[model samples]
Target: MNVETQKVKIFMQKHDNQKRALISILQDIQAEFNYLPKEALQDVAKTLEIPLIHIIGVATFYRSFSLEPRGKHQATVCTGTACHVRGGPKILDEFERKLGVEAGHTTEDRQFTLETVACLGCCAIGPVVVVDNEYFAHTSIREVGSILKKYRKKEKDNE
Candidate 1:
């Protein structure tokens, strides 16, 4: 079997007989695979006896769910009022400068997906960045490199 099939199999076992856990189950499955591949969603619908439209509906309704390809690392910069006043735009510029990708785009290497979110509710930690769901609060210009270091893979050309 292919790697994708194996992933679907593994995810299926995690569900509670595929009845009521579609949202959470699919969420977890999406977390594992980066994005919900069409085949994976179809497999889920087929196995759960849920319609494909139903699956799409659930997936699209939730902002956390991404239906397209996502990078290995997800970086969400806060663009709320507090963050904006606290040099959030500069921080975003630095990210785009360093990563070669703007918000809502992925790095060419597929190592990072950059996005902006509104109000993470940690206003005190203005200019916050959440990477792979782990919030890095009270951010500054110098810290961006250190955060990127944690997620970037070693490239052969560099080695």
Candidate 2:
């Protein structure tokens, strides 16, 4: 038995294994692993007696779900109309440059995952950045280093 198998067993025990709870099950799996590991998905399919394709479809259909391993910290730059005009693209570029990964890729160290969002409804503070669920309003390219530095320090501390 591997680590993923153990995690799947733990999560499967939380639910009744009914197909109706497929989404819920997937959520639990994602929450546990930060993404859906292929082994975990297989466990889910076997447990629920559902086809792997259906499970994969549900995971892929939801933007909130990540099929790949995600970093410990998630950083999202809002690229909506208001944010774009306010140099959101520049901010995003700064993040990519500092992190050495594209918008949709995680850092090699798995410390951070960078992403862009269409809107966060905080147009009043265009060019917003959300990191690990905390919103940073009125973000600027200059602030990217400081923001990333903070999370990097956090990762080091946890180590």
Candidate 3:
């Protein structure tokens, strides 16, 4: 409906007019829009000669893709066996409370995406939380709030 949304559709069209390329095109659109806009998905379906329902199905099926718009910062807490044993769940809970969103959800303001990763392969950093891909090892309830502030765009105090 808006100009940017229209541009999203046009970009999805440029990838190639193939229905099978939906997943990759959707990923590209998400990379540009910060999340998959519903309008963009519809456009991809229309331009690629694919069924809109099928596109929706693919988008919903993948955990790596989100149907809703995501925040600028993504906060992922490791939930691997090692991390879980080391209080990862509690750390995740703290993040949920502080950010006002549960894992697998984004903040209403779209400033943060809270998530849990099965493993980050950082076993030694078991209780790790990553903010925008920067690892924070040995995380604690006392440490999460301060760590979050560092990634926030509005954090003058953190600066």
Candidate 4:
């Protein structure tokens, strides 16, 4: 088996290949690859004896799962009512400008993927930006560059 298939099989084994553990298996696969790869999904369906359509349905049902490859870092801006009213749109715009990629897209360098969430559930901290799950409350347009820089610097240091 290929590396991907092997890895997916391990995930399935971890859940004892239970059909009911579909979501959990997918989560494991996503955690490994940062996204649900097509091959991995196929392997899952075949091994679990589940229909491919059903697998796809479950995969697409969750906003957290991405069929396409994501970036090394995920950057999400909250755009719910409170955030919107607090200049969330402008903050998103600033991120798009700085990253040179629109929301819902990954940068050409594959360093970051920019996304927008309806609400982060922290109305008091309107206009929140989360990178790799690190919440930046009360974010502003001026803070966009620094945020990106912080992640980029981490990448450089790791290299």
lDDT of 4: 0.93
Q: Give per-residue CA lDDT, model 3, range 1-159, as digits (tens).
A: 888767766766676566666777877877888777887877777777788898889888987788888888888999999999999999999999998888989899888899999998988977989888789999899998789877674555556
- Span of ten consecutive residues with least summed lDDT in model 2: 10-19
lDDT of 4 by residue, 1-159 (tens): 788889999999999999999999999998999999999998999999999999999998898899988999999999999999999999999999999999999999989999999987898987899999999999988899999999999999999
For model 4 the local lDDT of residue 155 reads 90
Clashing residue pairs in candidate 3 are: none
| lDDT per residue as tens, model 1, 1-159 | 788877787777787546688887788778788888888888888888888999999898887788878887789989899999998889999999999998988888887999998898999978899998898988998999988886664433455
Listed per model in order, the count of residue pairs whose N, CA or C atoms clash below 3 Å is 0, 0, 0, 0
- TM per candidate: 0.77, 0.94, 0.89, 0.94
What is candidate 1's CA lDDT for residue 95? 96
Show model 1 residue runs off by greater than 4 Å.
1-3, 13-16, 133-137, 141-146, 149-159
Report lDDT per candidate. Answer: 0.85, 0.90, 0.84, 0.93
Off by over 4 Å in 4: none
Q: Which number leads on lDDT?
A: 4
Ranking by TM-score: 4, 2, 3, 1
Ranking by lDDT: 4, 2, 1, 3
Report the CA-based lDDT of candidate 2 relative to the real structure: 0.90
